[model samples]
Target: MSMKNRHVLGEAVRHLILIILALYTLAPLLFLFVNAFKSNNEIIASPVALPEHWTLQYIKTAMEAINFGKALGLTFIITFFSILLLVIVSSFAAWAMVRSKTILSNIVFLCFTAAMLVPFQSLMYPLLSVFEKMGLKNVQGLILMYGGFGLSMSVFLYHGFIKSVPASLEEAAVLDGANLFQMFFKVVFPLLKGTTVTVIVLNGMWIWNDYLLPFLVIGNKTGSKTLTLELYFAKLTSGQYGNPWELIFPAVFVTIIPIIILYIFLQKYIVAGVSEGAVKM
Candidate 1:
């Protein structure tokens, strides 16, 4: 075959593969959306078919039953504060460990790195015990828990990115009478935009979607429930006979909208952050 023909054939193959992958990813979501408008009987009867009668009542009922607005609010609060705490604490710790050369600092950095390998299941009971003793079961408490769990990986990412930053700017800031707080926050933190965005997006998605941790910490709690936990309870409340597919589908869709919106807006930054983190020191 001619070289030109071979190249064209290869490109076609690649495009075909990409299209297949895209469809594979989108198929379930498409199914979910279609089923959201369907009644439970219709969904069971024709799982993949178009809805016999499109309606918004199921969506409305799901929203009300799940208390989706409240769950969304709680989720936003947890995700926002978790990311806030993770960024602040991880960035500072990364900066300090990178800049300061001491035995204790080295040990601390090593510990953080090591902690990343420790499975959460191993620590679940102990973490619960400690948090209970510390009274950290509410939204504020969950924020702290998320922060602690999120810190290690975040610090690892930040630590690598921080090393790529030149020391001269911070030195200049210090020479110009900037104190430690100003030097780190004003001079250093702003430069970490790429990594910070990466950390926030990564942790925000996890905390928002996470079910098990919140279930354990805030199970059946009247006023405090993350979106995922709310969905879990909704599923249970439906039971086997009274299958509430209509309710489940819309609730799932509503729960995911925020993260989808966030990703759409910050997608460029997320790409930039991952690229920078991957290639830079």
Candidate 2:
């Protein structure tokens, strides 16, 4: 074949591969969305086909059953506060470690880096016991736990990105009469906007969709449950005999909508922040 024809054929093959991967990734989500409008019988009978009669009945029922509004509000509060705490604490720690460049700082940074490899399951029971004894096994406690668990990765990212940032800017701010907080917040933190958004997007999705932490901390109680917890109990109360596909599909569909919308809007930042952070490191 001619070189031009070979190039064209290569492009065609790449496009075909991309299309297949896209469809593969999207297929399950598409199935869930379609089944949200379907009855259990309809879903079981024809899982792949479009619903014979699309209806909002299942969606409404799922919402009412799960106390969707309250759960959504609670989830938003937890995720927002958790991300805020992670960004503030992690950024401060990362910045200090990077600037200090001391033996102790290096050790601490290594500790944080090592922490990312430790599985939560290994510490889960002990953490719960400690928090329970401290009377922190509630919404407030959940937020704190999220901050602690999310800290290592956040610090790692911020550390890399902060290395890329010139220390002269902070020194200039200090020389101009800005205090510690002002120098860090105004001069340093603002420059970290990209990484901050990336941190929020990454941790927000995890916190929003997480079931285990909330289940262990909050116990699936009606009054103080996150969306994921609500969905769990919703399934349990739905029926004893078998899976409740109708309720399950719609509940999961609604629960994920917020995070999906968030990812859609902030999707661009994930790659940019990760690349910029890793650039210096």
lDDT by residue (1-281, candidate 1, tens digit) is 99999999999999999999999998988998899888888988998999988889888888877888898888898888889999999999989998887899889988988999999999999889988998886777778889999999888888888888899999999899999999999989999998898898889889988988898888889978888988888888876324678779888988888998887787778877876665664
Residue pairs in candidate 2 whose N, alpha carbon or C atoms collide under 3 angstroms: none
Candidate 2, residue 191: lDDT: 92
Q: How much lDDT does each candidate structure score?
A: 0.87, 0.93
Best by lDDT: 2
Give the residue spans of candidate 2 off by over 4 A. 240-243
lDDT score, residue 30, model 1? Answer: 95
| Clash tally for model 1 | 0
Give lDDT tens digits, candidate 2, residues 1-281: 99999999999999999999999999999999999998899999998989999899899989887899999999999999999999999999999999999999999999999999999999999999999999999999999999999999999999999998898998899889999999999999999988998999999999999999999999956599989999889888898423499999999999999999999999999998887776766
